[model samples]
Target: MSESLLHRCPVVPVVVIHDAAHALPLGEALLAGGITVAEITLRTAAGIGAIEALATALPELHVGAGSVLVAEHVDQVVDAGARFVVSPGLSVAVLARAQARGVAALPGVATSSELMTAVGLGVTEVKFFPAGLLGGPAAIRALAAPFTSMTFMPSGGVSADNMADYLAIPAVPAVSGSWMVDPGLLAEGRWDEVTARSAAAIRAARGSGAFQRVV
Candidate 1:
């Protein structure tokens, strides 16, 4: 897991694995499809094991722990070989824990105050969570005016359809979603479907035209 991996691609697959057994294969499929970063959310009991398995199996791919809301969750992910951590909301305690552990943390910020707090805490890159419900690209554009130095990884409701919209905003560093890694397909053991979707998402993001300007 490399800190720079998230920036290498515009989209990071937000994954939720219920079966730890499928972790390695699923990660390989995503990586084979040109998607290098995977965010395994701790939304299920299998998430930690899945992260561990994927990290061990796909040494070249970047694996991040997401939905980390507590300080302890940070420790758990760090111990499980997570290269970075992401939270749905900014928490001073959570950020402090990640900083102390020397792990890259992308805390979520939905408002100016939250963004300011993250900036004050030395966080330049954050997750614009629930992006669609929060006004999507327009909202992020407005926030970027005062915080020109800040960057974001907008997640939640982010898909191929609106990835271009988010990438057009200078403030957004990247975007993430589970659209590439469909849970239904995973549950049905459809690795081929997952790989195809992942490939399509990677191509769609690359073809969006906004990445050229940013790069």
Candidate 2:
């Protein structure tokens, strides 16, 4: 199950949709570009609706909810039919609710302390937030060495140019970013551009020559 969530695509687009109307077409664009997974962040009111729409219309896509912080938020997203949930920081309340709901959870961590907290809670996968500011790939390499069995999803400041750098590390099975599905493009209804960028991102990740079977 984790493999299906994090291994199907090396790069998971962290998308923010302004309108629920664009969900299906956006998922199609990303799918056409060789990407079968995406995290539709709950940064706006449209977020839950988008997740429901995507989960219903494109069950083939691994639709996830992001920026989820509390138990209520978890309940909301899970009830909306989100297959997974992502948070900006580790929250036991959210994690517990997600677990109760049977949805995969990827909580964010910015330091070794938080990482340890995740490990203590039986988490094997997490998001290294603000990765670039925390030293990007280098930081994750150092921080992950101690855990030895964890896989990190590097987000924030992750981009096309630096994807290879993150993928170079065996611990990083996948990296999440919004470069391909920028909110502006969705706002403009630029479906073709979205598809092209998604395709280009996939090619870049595959050709980075840093990919390894993480699981």
Candidate 3:
């Protein structure tokens, strides 16, 4: 991968768009807030269509697909124009499919075994899901010490309130969460609120000075 996902943007908005029509405006809102990349999860039926819509409407945004659980889902997402793939757990089949499709895969790793497995699979970066519940920054600190070359993106429970904490760790170049693009905000068509939250998240991450280079 020429550009690492974590470095593309300090905060990668994890969005669950209920309506495919909302994709364009949502992308615009994120871009307006200084965000250039985002992950549209497949938790809802509209996920794939949303990815396709955003891909066609906003070519500049580095859009990715999240909640990818199966290898078939990987194919579906790639066909929909997802530049990358994100999963909530480490799945060899899913990662392998992403590699075959020739896109970056940000698989989740909640334990050392999973991290090691990911390394063996040629993955350099991973998503630390349920981060706050899994000991948060402290856990990442301890887990990251063993893998000097690996980096992490803390997911669940990550917010502006604790984004700085995650960025403080040298291993974490960026963090992922839905606070900015929460489903509720999207459902309400609150584009302005989305932009505001996105801006605030970026400002918080930048304050840590950890966004030196994206790649």
Candidate 4:
């Protein structure tokens, strides 16, 4: 499940929806732009509802929960039809609960110790949060040196300008960020702009040789 989800798109848009009504259109816009996966964040009250709306109404758009912080949150998102769960940091309870519930968990790892913990938990994929602050793709390359079996998805600080850099690393199967689904664009209901950005991102990913690198 983790491999399938990661390979669906080289750029996973990290979305934060303030209104559930906008969920359907957003999903359609992404699909129109050639993106297949979205990480709807639990950063707002409408997040869970948005997840459910998209998951149920547009099953083709692989929906997942982001900014998930606890075991309970995992239950909430999985129940809402999230195919996967992402957190800002690794948590034993979160990973355990996700495994128990049969949902893929992509917990964040910013250090070698965290990566070790995730490995012990049987996690094969992880999100590298605040990628820029943590040294971006170079940091991921260094961190992945010993964990050759693990793949990474760089999240925070990821943007079109630097997404290619992240995808250039063989260990990075995908990159996640909110640039394609920026709050301002959503607030203004600029679905066209969203589609354009999403399409451009996909084009960039392909140009970066993401498909050739993904195993």
Give the top-scoring candidate (lDDT): 3
* TM-score: model 4 vs. ground truth: 0.96
lDDT of 2 by residue, 127-181 (tens): 8998989899989999988989788999999998999888878888889999999
Which residue runs does candidate 1 get wrong by more than 4 Å? Answer: 1-5, 210-215
- Estimate candidate 1's alpha-carbon lDDT, on a 0 to 1 scale: 0.84
Two-way TM-score contest, 2 vs 3, winner: 3
Candidate scoring better on TM-score of 1 and 2: 2
Candidate 4 ranges with C-alpha deviation above 4 Å: 1-4
lDDT (Cα, 0-100) at 210 in candidate 2: 32
TM-score for each of the candidates: 0.94, 0.95, 0.97, 0.96
Q: Superposing all C-alpha atoms, what RMSD in Å does each candidate have to the true structure? A: 2.0, 1.6, 1.2, 1.3
Candidate 3 ranges beyond 4 A from true positions: 213-215
Q: Report the C-alpha lDDT of model 3 over 79-144, residue by residue, as the tens digit.
A: 999999999999999988988998899999999999999888878999999899999999999999
Q: What TM-score does model 3 achieve against the real structure? A: 0.97
Q: Return the lDDT, model 3, position 80.
A: 96
lDDT per prediction? 0.84, 0.87, 0.91, 0.90
